[model samples]
Target: MLTNFRRPRTERMRGGGAYVEQRTNSWAALVGFLLGRGYSAPAIAEALADGTSDATVRKMAQRWGLPAWGRKADGFIVIPMKLRDRATIASRAAQEGLGQEEYCRQFLVAGARERGTFRSVVKEGLDL
Candidate 1:
């Protein structure tokens, strides 16, 4: 004759008690960090020096909704301005029948030309 026997089950620990998260070497993470620190895509790429291109960094920044710093390579500038200033610009742009970007570009170029600094600035790269 044989009797059936049952064994008690043991429970394992759940949740991350004493668990340390490891740092990742992902490019996206690096891009986000650099962008958060106000570093331009070109600057970030140069800092990385890992064969990553500026375009790639820009794309990553856009995908992650990061505040990308303005650079010539980006073909545009992102100026941080007050809401009231932006509204004024928007109104002026509408009156001129030009998009916000074109209005800003034209305004900057006109100012630079008037100041006689445009030529020199273009010849010798902008100081950022």
Candidate 2:
């Protein structure tokens, strides 16, 4: 089969000053890049998704601090202690029969999907 690997679309915001994107190799990275550039995580994600939906962005913001973006120097919110507990990691590992590294990779996909960075996860945990 043959096809054109078109670059993801880049559209100017409604009024004009800002722009959104569609091509991202790593969704988490997309969020990080947006933060590094000073865009609110949701705004960046919403732009990337062409303003079609805000669910993903909202979810990411809620879970990973996309909505609560600010000049934290760390670029984004650090994982809250409640959500960063090792027990959760252990449970997740046991659930997927995956090690820590694999479990972490799954977050990359989750982060992407959370912010509408991509449609599917390229590196699934446990290969399942």
Span of 10 residues, lowest total lDDT, candidate 2 = 1-10
Q: Which segments of candidate 2 are over 4 A away from where they belong?
A: 1-25, 50-52, 65-67, 70-128
What lDDT score belongs to each candidate, Candidate 1 first? 0.65, 0.53
Best by TM-score: 1
lDDT of each residue in 13-56, candidate 1, tens digit only = 33655543332345456667667766666776777665678898
TM-score of 1: 0.45
Pairs of colliding residues, candidate 1: none
Error at 51, model 1, angstroms:
10
Report the C-alpha lDDT of model 2 over 9-99, residue by residue, as the tens digit.
Answer: 3433344655554434465455555554555544565556555345565465577654454444534322324545667887888899998
